[model samples]
Target: MSLKPGNIVEGKVVNITKFGAFVEVEGKIGLLHISEISNSYVKDVSEYLKENDIVKVKIVSIGEDGKISLSIKQANLEEQKKSCKPEEVDWNSKKRKTNSIDFEDTLSKFLKESEEKFKDLKNYKNLKNGTYAKKKNR
Candidate 1:
């Protein structure tokens, strides 16, 4: 079958890299990017696939430069992914406003904590170097 977007096809893993694997389908080589290799976080591609292994992949996209992008996860998803579409969101909802406020507050809190830690680190360094004199009772 001709390689097209969303088309599930069988391809041979021609090469494997730290980032991803190259699969040859229909006499054309396509890059199965690391992100597209699996649904979960993949630390190593070799754990899931090996060179010359035949894999079922979904054609993700074909670039204007003749580059083909393939996805094994999408091939597995197929009908399930369509049925599990994310619920529609109201962009102007009150929840979004509250979330933004919460984010800003969290960021300020993080910055304050960071500054306090840095101050303590500086003081500790100074004390270790004998730059800070001990307070004597008056």
Candidate 2:
């Protein structure tokens, strides 16, 4: 079978190099780059996978030189998809506003916080400049 870009397939690790692993899938050999091997950190390919290991991989890209780039990460991501349903995202939900909420109170709260931060900064600067002195008890 002719392998195409973006097709998920099963492959065996025929060879492993420092840069990547050679996977033979359905009589078609592809390069599984180190970057595409796993979702999490993989310090060494041998530690994560070994020769003759069977793994499901996704065809991420195809170069003009007929180099098939496979991704184990993509395959793992596909597996994760099977466990969850696609969430119905309501884009219009962002536009919804409650009438009971007062905007002025939020604004005043933000302004009050800003004033307090500014006062603290001013006090720090004055202290650094030796303009602040301890008051003497009368």
Candidate 3:
């Protein structure tokens, strides 16, 4: 079977390295990079895959020199979609929750805190320039 970009196919892990694993798909070898092994961080490629292990992979790219790049994570699109559930909020509830502060209030609070910090900085600068007096030690 001909393999192209976005093609999902079954492959065997022929060889593994620190960087990635080589997969044999339909008599053709493809490189499954460590990053493409999973959506999460992969500290060890061997931990997730091993030699001769069968896995489904997606063809991410094909170089002119016949270097095929594959992705195990990208092949499982259904699994990724199933795991991600949209958060639903009840907008019609009569008892409106006021506990969560709105954006405008948060912005105003941040600006007030920023102004206080600027004032403190200005005072410190004045003290450093000898324009502001330091209290004498009794």
Candidate 4:
């Protein structure tokens, strides 16, 4: 089959290098770069793909000489669709249980605690400066 730029195909890894893997697709070779392997950061290419491993890859680029570049990330996304079933939800199926305090109440408590701390600090500063005095009732 003729490989196109948008086609996703299965290929056997023929060789692996620090930069990428050379995969053979229908007797034609393609470069599966390390960056194209996954969405996550890959510290080492051998950890995921190895020589002689068959993997599904998406055609990324086609050069003037027909050298193909492929991506494993695209292939995995396609495979995940096939193995997983669609989830359907009924509005009354189950009620979601909430396990948290009221947001406004939490904020008010935090503010009160902060004001007390600030007043304590101000009192300490005034006492250190010899200006602290007790207020008397008239």
Candidate 5:
């Protein structure tokens, strides 16, 4: 069967390399790149996939030379959207409101928070080192 972009297909992983994995789909071999493995950072491809594992992948591109690029992340995303209920609010659909604060007010708020954090750190260090009781007496 011919593969096209955005087509979801099931493939069995035949080989794996540091860069990507080769999957066999309908008697054809396709490359599932490591970066396309997941939406999240994939430090190790083997950790997420292995040889002989069947995976559902979306065909991202098919080159003139017949190099097929597949994405498991895209397929998973499509499946998740189909199975999950639509979100009530799409936060990304609307532009975020930026509350404009005066520079003076912003600086003062930052300074106040920083002072409180510094005091907490100092108190933590004193307590850890058994110096808090000494300071309390003074």
Candidate 6:
């Protein structure tokens, strides 16, 4: 089968180096870089692959010089993403609950609280500056 980008193919690990393992896929040998080996840190390439270990890898890219870059971690991740189903959100399903409390009553309470807080702040500011503002007899 013809190898292309995003193609998950089974290949044989013919050689393993400190950096990565070279695998033969469809008679074409490509470099599976150490970074592409796994999602976690790979201290040694030999620990993952033997002299003749079959591995499934994703074709990352192909250079003009026929250099093919492969990835094992990406292959695993892509498979995981494929298996996962996206959650369908029902935007209009949940109806908004109507409040029984009167709007005017709530507004009046908020306004009264705000005015009291403002008056207290003003009194505090005047006291700090050593000046007392005369309160109007309401």
The TM-score values for the models, in the order shown, are 0.57, 0.61, 0.58, 0.73, 0.61, 0.63
Q: Pairs clashing in candidate 5?
A: none
Candidate 2 runs further than 4 Å off: 86-138
Better of 3 and 4 by TM-score: 4
What lDDT tens digits, residue by residue, belong to model 4 across residues 1-138? 678887888899999889989999888999999898889998889999878999989888899988898999988887787799978878787665587677898999999999999999999998866643443321
Query: Can you write out model 3's per-residue Cα lDDT over 4-95, one digit (the tens) per residue?
Result: 99888999999999999999999999999999998899999999998999999999999999999999999998456768999998889778
Model 6 worst lDDT run, 10 consecutive residues: 129-138
Q: What is the lDDT of residue 124 in candidate 1?
A: 92
**Predicted candidate 1 versus true structure: per-residue lDDT over 55-127, tens digit per residue:** 9999999999999999998888995776787989887875544435576788999999999999999999988
Off by over 4 Å in 5: 87-138
**lDDT agreement with native, every candidate:** 0.90, 0.86, 0.91, 0.87, 0.91, 0.91
Question: What lDDT, from 0 to 1, does candidate 1 have?
Answer: 0.90
Once superposed on the true structure, which residue ranges of model 6 sit more than 4 Å away at CA? 87-138
**Candidate 3 residue-pair clash tally:** 0
Give the clashing residue pairs of candidate 4, or none: none
Which pairs, if any, clash in model 3?
none
- Candidate 1 vs candidate 4, TM-score winner: 4
66-88: candidate 5 lDDT, tens digit per residue: 98999999999999888999769
Question: What is the clash tally of candidate 5?
Answer: 0
Candidate 1 vs. true structure, TM-score: 0.57
Candidate number that wins on lDDT, 1 or 4: 1
Report the Cα lDDT for residue 67, model 3.
95
Best by TM-score: 4
